[model samples]
Target: MVMGFREFCDYEWFSFTMENYVVHILFSKSEPGPLLEGKSKYVELGGVYSAQLHQAHTSVGQTHIHVYARNNQLFAMNHDGSAHDRSHGSQIPNKVAQAITQKFPNFTLPKDNYIESAPSGIVNAFGHQLLLG
Candidate 1:
């Protein structure tokens, strides 16, 4: 069984293959299909547990697509939807505040939305301040 992204409206069938004993391919579609177009490619998101995925995200500037985990605590990759990572600025957008706030209820922000303790240009990356222990 396969599901498609309604946004693309492309007709394509998903295929699942087991390369080795360690990988399981699920919820996949071909090119021009839903969620596979527009500067999208397979990437490995790094964090507590690594997961390979196809995510659409910006490489620079203000626009980006993040392939975050269901919990939104880990980062998969940022492509800027381009062939190269330099096509756009390499920084997480401020809009991520909304996503983080939804995930971590303990998250709190002062008057400013940006990371206050971070350096001038540096931010928390995922939004909100990281309290030091």
Candidate 2:
């Protein structure tokens, strides 16, 4: 099955992100609040996103989309927070970096550290310990 689609986020934040296509993976030490107009992509993985990259359709000060690879494959995280265990690679990021390079020859997608920092099976149940740890 070839998924020739675009746009996705972590399961916990999947539904919310759908409400607004703009993925705002936060890096600041802040909580998701009214200020976070988009899908509230938290700082689970400290990465840098250029405000110029995020596409249109949004009402916020900053904007950028989040893309990650699990087990060397790129798939949008579900809304149920089920995609927890896997290796995060730079597959999609490589593409984005290439696209940006066309215009800004000095662009590199910031490697997401969630898969690097968090242990296996920890990405899904982050902070939601009450669910099942």
Task: List lDDT for all candidates, in order.
Answer: 0.34, 0.33
lDDT of 2 by residue, 52-77 (tens): 22322223222233434332223222
Per-residue lDDT of candidate 1, residues 1-133 (tens digit):
3233333232433343355433322333333333444444423333322223343322222322334444442332222222123322333334444443443334343224432333333343533444442
Clashing pairs in 1: 57-65, 57-80, 58-64, 58-80, 59-80, 60-88, 60-89, 61-89
Find the 10 residues in a row with the least total lDDT in model 2: 75-84
| lDDT of the structure predicted as candidate 1 | 0.34
Question: lDDT of candidate 2 vs native?
Answer: 0.33
Model 1 lDDT, residue 85, Cα? 31
- Candidate 2: list runs displaced more than 4 Å: 1-64, 68-87, 93-95, 102-107, 110-133
